[model samples]
Target: MRKNIQILQDIVSRKGSSKVLTFSIPHVFKALQLLDKEGFVSRATFAKEIHLGEGAVKTLILHLKKAGIAESTKSGTFLTEKGKKLTNQIKNTITKECKVKKSSIIQGKYNHAILLKKYSKMIKTGIEQRDYAILYGSSGCTTMIYKNEKLVFPGNERECFPRDAKTKKYIIENLCPHEEDVIIISSSDDPFVAEISAKNAALWTIAIG
Candidate 1:
């Protein structure tokens, strides 16, 4: 797993003379997810789905190709065997993600949550995840760890959203999180921003943890 994280680090990190990247690690993983689901995707399709411009999407494809993770053919763009394996590995770490309605915990119009597998030990204050989400264009982020079948904020033993039972029940029933799992919810007015914000924070946690 550490080796896989290092591989992603290289994709996001700048070498001595590489062009400045407009995209980040989350974009890379999202692109991989798209390819894994669709099998083959076009630059236009990739741009539309990943929320990147054509030029930036092209550059991302080049990076993936250089890493031997994907290739472009007459049919469009498709992941290589290495890319598929990497995507599966990433899916293992980030178990599930979904859009959730605004609730007492996250009060934005649009919210998304990402489940990071067994990352409770790496979460100290959760401020890091929140800061990352804010930097990605969100008001704030809520981080919770699943323990004793309930979601609780870091350093707090009590259950989160105790005052909002409906939201709490929905989260618990939908996410189906296990013990030691970490849930990160980011909120924004824009739906895409909300999704990206949550995913970005999750990626940061994986990168640093």
Candidate 2:
């Protein structure tokens, strides 16, 4: 299974330009066929759903198109006759493949083996040396961070405020201290970070991982 994943990763990373010199297990091939049946997935969505990198998905799409098994329109992707037929013929195989892939991803995330290794390295570098870490982003963003490592502040309590201007200002003013420095972790560069910092008279620092 690991070998198959490595092959798929290579194929996607190489934009399917690499020649298939190795045999992919029947299960892996079936899973690819099933994904092809689902027509156009956005780069981000595909990465999030399949646990593959965006660059790899882009390459895989290109390769699938070249193989005449998939057709990608602007909005989404549709399976070609070949792709649909292949998926239908190998329905059982595809189901097994999907289960295997899903299990692998779930295990990876639930165990936090890979993610925690990365976070532990970051923390060791003094990146987490702060009085408090203000994770200002969507709920999904905060959840992902919490999954990677245990939160030190709030004593195991996770709080999320609505993304409203007035409420945001109030939270920053109350939670942040003027004299002490706090670290700000944002998924993106947005004005909300600046607004929160300005309101609290605190400096916003980015957390690099």
Candidate 3:
């Protein structure tokens, strides 16, 4: 399951009625209550955000009513004070429980030429449909520039080598051009990949997920 914090962020960012809370449905009332208490949303707006029909939203409102976390008024459904407090408590509890430390970097050389060629056709199709560029990179820093099936840089020695923090920094500084996107795959989690990703905000990083 996705972490509650992520779910909460999604709910807060979505626009519409307070019914967006219904999207959290069975699982996200606590967060929804926070949005409500903040006056950031209304029950009907929440329903619209979640794409629920009026009947489904009404059912959820009934449940919230029985729990005493919500009340209906001429204006719209508003969260009760208890509901607001509970939402704050849930946010704090989840934040405290969900800290993750960064992991160490691992290195392994990879030759993406073959994979690039295979995906080239697909990429070309996309480019033909819509203008786009195929951007590639690696944590190993072993990418050899190729043109016409011939290696450009690094000549004959195309094998990738493990890079320490200093080496990774140097490779990125020298190799990654500005405004270029990169694809990173490594034997282990590489901080360099993260560093590059941060530096180039336009860059897109695709991990296994």
Candidate 4:
């Protein structure tokens, strides 16, 4: 899976003199996720769903095709067998998620918390996930790990937001994370942005693994 993630990370970069990619590593996964859910995707739909312009979408589709991940036709773009395997891998890794209500601990009007399975060791200060979410245009990301029946920040055993039991209980009940699982909460004014932000940060965690 790490090798495959490295492959995905590589695809986001320019190959020699080729055009610079307008998408990020997480956008590649999100695109695959869209195809896996919808089965097929048109350029316009892809642009709208992935929040990219038509030219960027066009190039993105081209890259997917070149990578043997997807194919396009009159119906639209559909994942290839290889793409299906990769998409399923990603879906199974994420496990579960939930919508979070605005609270003092949350930064924006909307929020989403995604559960990353057994990747707590990949966290280092939880700063990388925040950087990833911010780079993806979200307000911020809060990364916490489930350990010893408590939610805590990485690199130590300190409980995260221990004073905010209400929010902590909400997250614990909804996500149901097991030991070593990571919980990433992303916040933004736009609900969709919040969702993608958490997902992008989750992808970063997975790739880092």
Local distance difference test scores for all models: 0.87, 0.33, 0.35, 0.85
**Model 2 lDDT, residue 158, Cα:** 35
In model 3, what lDDT does residue 174 have? 38
| Candidate 1 residue pairs that clash | none
Model 4 scores a TM of 0.87
- Candidate 3 on 150-203: residue-level lDDT in tens? 222233433233333454344334333222112222221433332222212111
lDDT of 1 by residue, 1-209 (tens): 66776777677666674678888877887888899999999999999988888888888888788888899998889999999999899899897888889877789899999999999999998899999999889887999999988889998666897788888788878788999999999999998889888988998788788
Q: After superposition, how far is residue 87 of candidate 2 from its true place, in Å?
A: 1.0
Scored against the true structure, residue 159 in model 1 reaches a CA lDDT of 84
Q: What is the lDDT of residue 163 in candidate 4?
A: 81
Q: Write the per-residue lDDT of candidate 4 for residues 26-67, one digit (tens) a residue.
A: 778879888988998999898888888988998888888888
Q: Estimate each model's TM-score.
A: 0.94, 0.33, 0.33, 0.87
Better of 1 and 3 by lDDT: 1
Candidate 4 deviant stretches above 4 angstroms: 161-166
Q: Considering every candidate listed, which one attains the maximal lDDT? A: 1
Better of 3 and 4 by TM-score: 4
